[model samples]
Target: MKWVRSKICGITRIEDGLCAAHMGADAIGLVFYEKSPRYVGLDQARSIVQAMPAFVSIVGLFVNAQAAQIKQTFDYVGLDLIQYHGDETASFCEALALPYIRALRMQPDVDIAQVAKTYVNARGILLDSYVPGLPGGTGEVFNWSLIPSLDKPLILAGGLSSTNIAQAVAQVQPWAVDVSGGVEQAKGIKSAEKITDFMQALRANR
Candidate 1:
């Protein structure tokens, strides 16, 4: 478990958030992107974040939202980290001050080294599948071989299920892995069994 962090995203329900924490999620992502089916309002997010046990982080997901909007969300939810999942510039991301990650939409032969350099100051970089006209949470993985050797921490995401998570952990040995649709019964709904299975797989690999 040297580098096996995991994030459970698209959490809309308080029960699901609690379950993720109880089952040992390193962090929980609350989607603030309105267009996403997994989006949760500030009030709901506030309640869930407030109830989480200590050391389990609360991450807020944004997609090209304004500075004021991000500030509002942070004020209301008190996020431990922010995840930018759209075409946000490094300046926009850096202005937040709070720790954050810039997601790179993985595509065929994308220059990951350049991408990492562009956001060098970010807490980490999240590599996810490239899906046109869609936000994150597609549950479609990109070619893992495309990952370039880099100095920064990489967060592996997309199409990660319990069965393949151990394999992924062994191959990429990423700083963290993110899951949303892969462990879901439907959009915004999660399965506790899937969560347990995914963690078990990660542990077994360790």
Candidate 2:
């Protein structure tokens, strides 16, 4: 059976983090970018990290952050992986020395295969919806038809929810699906019921 892994992102509360873990989420994202409403402070991130159970990966998300800031957050939060959500060059991402995923915002004329090849060292290529000013967490779905066959693993994101995840998985058959606002009751706040429903939907499709 091909199981589609799920990651519940934008976790700001300890309870939400634990809920995601308990609900069989493969990973939980912690936002480090201060400008986003879903951003988590170092102390808050630490608390969430400490409270989470083992085996669930802690992914730290950044948006063109300085290396020093990333290192400081890594040391304090003990992130297992990094997700770069800005216009960071492959070299800059590699310099961090941590397993990372590169987010490619899918625009109308973007060349995904070429970008994926460019970031060939990335653990996976995360496809997200391209919004004019926002980096990520846009809560808007892109054209699933635009995705191309690639050499690296694929993690499909952007506007994924309980209602549409199954269809998205059946269409894309990605290694994983990432959700943030889709499972949230409000910005930075997750809804346990939504998470459970989303997982159930994904499992049913698989």
Whose TM-score is greatest here? 2
lDDT by residue (tens digit), candidate 1, 114-198: 8778775788899998898876888897888778886788999989999889888888889999999887888899998887888
The residue pairs in collision within model 1 are none
Predicted candidate 2 versus true structure: per-residue lDDT over 167-202, tens digit per residue: 999999999999999999999999999999998898
| Stretch of 10 with least lDDT, candidate 1 | 107-116
Regions of candidate 1 where Cα sits further than 4 Å from its true position:
none
Model 1, residue 106: C-alpha shift (Å)? 0.8
Clashing pairs in 2: none
- For model 2, the stretches where C-alpha displacement exceeds 4 angstroms are none
